[model samples]
Target: MLPLAAGPPFGPEHTMILEQAATALTLARLTSSPAWDRRAHSSVLLDLLHWRYRSRTEARLRAEALGLPTTGHRLVPVVVDHPGAPSADGVALTDHLASELLSSGVKALVGDLAEGRSGLLLALARASAWQPVVERIARELRAAFGPDVVVAVGPGVTELGQVTRSFREAEEVADAIGPASRDRPFHVASDIGLPELLYSLRDDVRLQKYVEQQLGRLVQHDARHGSDLLDTLRAYLDAAGNKSIAAKHVGLSRQAFYQRLHTIERLLGTDLESGAQRTQLHVAVTALESLGPPAELG
Candidate 1:
């Protein structure tokens, strides 16, 4: 309730004016509350993640308003996906994660990403500090959400405009890990070995061409005849050219595996015993697995 003016000169009009002013004040207070601030932070973070600003000046201004670093800081994009979580509210999950990070002395801006998924922009004083920070985030998220939560940490960038690249890398890491991420819930893009190199070139036409050049005939044969020739080749290569071991792994007798290997060599026009050809095919196979299905190449 508003205090009435002294001297009894107030009328109904004055009361109405006071009431309107009080309503405005209440709205202003509401907008400045912590929940509202979280929403604002999320909005700015989504803009950053999507590179929605028209110019760096505009982006910097918005980030500055939210106390987010735009210069003299490195930002690492981290994506978290919890498929087993009970709730599908991404915004609420992000808000909870952001609050937890804040309490742990970590500065992060959170945004919703698909259902049950969240994106975070972690502010770092140095890019080298990302590993520890990401580990801490993974630990916290696992403790809060569950062990099934997947966390993918991308490379750190110094500019706000470059955050989109980091976010995309993180997203790719998450996708590449897929449902097989339970054994290792936390993955950093830079440290994921060969897949990281392949993922970096996922958009290159040459990468797809190389896979086609090396294994296209085998893949086509498998699709046409509904054969396991491609799987046979992979098993053979994975076993380091040991035909017997590869045969056992694929549940085939040595003679049956040899027949498939012979067919593979004939179709691919390469000797399975050539070290150079084996290395080349191995790389192509790795590219196919890392970058997803060969059908996606077309």
Candidate 2:
């Protein structure tokens, strides 16, 4: 068994913990019960605890709250206390209370990854949850954390006796692809499938080569021009192909935007205005999004 501080299901309790989490999700869905929702939240916390917390006592306390045994597992938890209007003490207290709640199994340990606009922006990147859905979460988080706080959640692994490799992988992807600016934030960790695909590519040279061939020119041009043309393209698509808006966003003049578009057209050997061409470009971009950044082509 792993040390109690190492994480979940090291020896005897693994099966039970997993069962409880699964059951909780099932119960919540089947019964439409808030209690089950609470349990699902607890499971999220449990996963976070296994990834972040450092002490056996801490681990035990968190598991116990979730109605799990602390005998064979540890708690790894990440707590983010935003610096917001209510004061540092408030944030600390909230974090402390949150830790206590996790110890009692009240919520997930992955705190809000971003604050205010940044959090909302990150949510916007998710096509699944539309504006209202993200807006509500953002509003609640803003009220709870206070206006100035920015938070983001990193991926975590909770299963005990497992390699730390996956955990480290999640953290690296989170950090590398996490939004540099809160204003235009995105949590790469939240999109589990994409990062998984990205890391998987490290082992698949053939697929990597294919991606390189498709995006080689764009990658090269970005390097040469010192501009994030890829991001610009994404932003343009996200804005529904509005050059004026794209220019305004990146602080370029309309003429410059047109010039860049021409350059992009020339380099990519595709027409942005054509429906068929735009559709293909969108598909390519989505595929590359899952692949993360491309390697420099020879």
Where model 1 places Cα greater than 4 Å from the true spot, the runs are 1-35, 43-91, 102-105, 112-118, 123-133, 139-150, 154-183, 199-205, 290-298
The lDDT per prediction is 0.76, 0.48
TM-score of 2: 0.36
- What digit string (tens of lDDT, one per residue) describes model 1 on residues 9-123? 7776566556545644554566556677666666777777778876676666666655566677888888888775753345355667877777877766776776767788888
TM-score, candidate 1, is 0.62
Backbone collisions counted per model: 0, 19
lDDT of 2 by residue, 71-117 (tens): 33332222232444353344433344344444544323333333411
lDDT of 2 at 214: 56
Which candidate wins on TM-score? 1
